[model samples]
Target: MAKKQHYKHNNGAMYLMLSPYLLLLFFFGILPAIMGVLEIPKPSMANANGGWDAFKIVIHDFRFGPALRHVLGFMGIFVPLMIFFVIGMALMLDIKHSPWKKWLRMAYIVPASISGAVAVLVWYVILQPTLSPIKGVLRYFHITESSQIWQQQNLVYILAIMAFFAAAGNWILIQYGSLQSISTEVLEAARVDGASVWQTAIRIKLPLISKYIVYMSVLVFAGGLQIFVEPQLLNGGIYQGIADSWSFDQLSYNLAFMQGDFGGASALSILLLIPSLLGALLVIFKTDMFEGAQGHIKKKDVEIVGI
Candidate 1:
């Protein structure tokens, strides 16, 4: 009877500890998500027929398809490259006996401390048409009279590169943490068994860290989907080659603030939520990550019969 009362008291304390976070999530996360799906009038409803009609107009606008395509294209180019580079750097840093490892790790993580918007601004200055370092190089080589790299479609690739440079450091830290959690004894046994570094990485390290890789991939993909500040700050938030609404987040921003169509923005926001929610579900269910079932299967059955 005393133990039962003690257990109940502990449970009450635990609930009290969790109440703040639960309340915060309820008000900020759940409430906003529910409100986003609810039908609301556009601020410009008087000017544009009605809320539903305003939403339709925004959806059917000429820029919608092209903007979505541009964002998707940028994600396609950036996410995979960042994942590969971050994982590789993490592996390199995970070498415990390497010289200068501390400095190398610090260098990799330094970019993560910088804000995304600030990083974009710095890159914009570096990649400007006239004062760019590349421009100086080209001029020295007599390659062209002016720097036109930022004017062409190639600017998308440059933007992707800048994003990778700014964000890859944080991902490298995540991957490194996962790598460090792996058992050193297993690696030593593999080395004693004459397994080469490449072979061990492929067969052991990669398999062990597969779940972390998947998690990072999903997280980065979702983040890439919501990209705004980098492109907006870099391109001056105009409808130029890459428009103001190039990303889904930017689309919602343009609808609500620029066009005064809150209903349309909410609809677009709900659409954006779908991909992120689906990606999260996939990470939770489709992968062996959350359940710790990656490589725990044991005992394969074998049958022998008279031939």
Candidate 2:
């Protein structure tokens, strides 16, 4: 009776904690997706009266190829670097009795706290050799000219770096917290079994936290596809056409607002969403991520999964 009661209590607490995220996901993610799907069939100038024509128009656009390449390039650099560094730094921080752990955690999140237009402005200044505090370093890298740093070829690398720093801090702390969920007893056993720290982290901790890594990958990939602000702001703020519609998101924005083709935008968004959605479903359903150690899905998880 007591065990059942405790389990129910835990379930309630879990749902309570998840409620805010659920609400946001429903409102911002699911609702928008639904709306985008509906809007896909609506008539539009870009589509010349929409009905999958919007999809054709968007996919066939000249900007589409470059945008896809740019975003793919950003993800190629950002996602791996993010996963590697975030896990590495989190593991480094999780070392027992590390004196600087708390300070380092705080340092990691400071950049994340600086957000929105401010982050854009800050990055702009930082990337500019003449204005940046690290001008000497920029010059060392042969980026003395804004022309050098802001070129078409260098934009992918630049965007990747900017996105990585902006996001890595928060992910590091999240992954670190995930690390803390690991059983100290298990870690002790690993040590007792002559497993070195590296071996334990690689062989034990990494596998234990694999689900979180998948979650991060899905979100990171989705966010990478939705890259808009950096390219858009950079284009408008400094160089007028350098990264103009350099991402699919920017292209969608231009289609909807500039070109007055909401249907095309919605179709494009749906097309972009398919990969992230499929990837998430594959990870979630194929793995035993939501299952308990007993090889059954937990009741709470089952209920959520059903929904």
Candidate 3:
């Protein structure tokens, strides 16, 4: 009873401390989400379902279709590949006696830190045939012009690579940290059962950290869906309308600022947000991730008692 009370008191104090940030989140994040629902464009007198008609307009628009395809394709590539590499690298990195571990961790982080405009510039230089170190490879593929490389169809691969480098490093370290939490006792028992190194990692280590991976996947999907800066900077920076409205976010930006269609922008935003919200709920329920989170809170409570 005393421990429960102390735990409640500590949590209450923490929440109290966090109130300001929570308030700001409500004002900025939650408030806009709520407002977006109401701000969906209202249709004309001819259309009976005004909001639905407006939403349909945004959906059926020519630009919306291409942007939709681009985002879906981008997510398809980025999500699976990112998960595979992050997990594989993290598992390899967890090797007990690896001397390169410390330096390798730094190596992952450094590239990840070079993000946003810098990443765009870095990738641009690398892709630019005259400037690239891989100019020989480009020429061998018979690529001579920027147009050959920067085609609309190839943006999927281009953006995926940029997004991967921008994010995969941090996720590798995060997955590595999750790998560290696997109990040594369980691992020893696996060894006693004659499990090889790869076998132990597959059968023992992965399941323990699976929830974190699911959580990471959910967030990555959400982030990829909201992709803007990469395509935006590419189009706006140098290419000038080459990738204009290449993503949902870019389309939404055009609706709001360029076209002055706030309602359409809000409608588009709501549409994009739906999948993210559903993905989060799916993770929480389908994986029982919320239940696992409760255990973490209990673990913290036990730690407080030890203190």
Give me the candidate number with maximum TM-score. 3
Model 2, span 1-307: residue lDDT tens: 9999999999999999999999999999889888989998788776665587777778999989988899889889999999999999888887775767788889999888765566778877888888998888998888877777778898889888888888999999999999999998999999999999899999999999998898888888888878888888878887899899999999999998998888888888888888887777656665655555535544566466553
Off by over 4 Å in 2: 1-32, 283-307
Model 3, runs deviating above 4 Å? 1-19, 42-50, 136-144, 285-307
Candidate 3 TM-score, C-alpha based: 0.84
lDDT of 1 by residue, 1-307 (tens): 9999999999999999999999999999999988876644444552254455545666686767876777777887899898888888887677555667767778888877665777766665665546666777656655453345555466457667877887898888888888887898999999999998778777888889998898888888888888887767655633254445656677778778887767787877777788888778667656667666545522231111111
Consecutive 10-residue window with the lowest summed lDDT within model 2: 290-299
lDDT per residue as tens, model 3, 1-307: 9999999999999999999999999999899898888777454332335665668788877899899889889999999999999999999898774767789898998888877899899988888888988889989998878778888789999999999999999999999998888888998899999999999889899999998889999999999999998899999997887789999999999888987777788888998888898787667555756774765555455355442
TM-score of each: 0.79, 0.82, 0.84
lDDT of 2 at 191: 91
User: What clash count goes with each model?
Assistant: 0, 0, 0
Q: In candidate 1, list every pair of residues with a backbone clash.
A: none
Each prediction's whole-model lDDT (CA): 0.72, 0.85, 0.86
Estimate the lDDT of model 2: 0.85
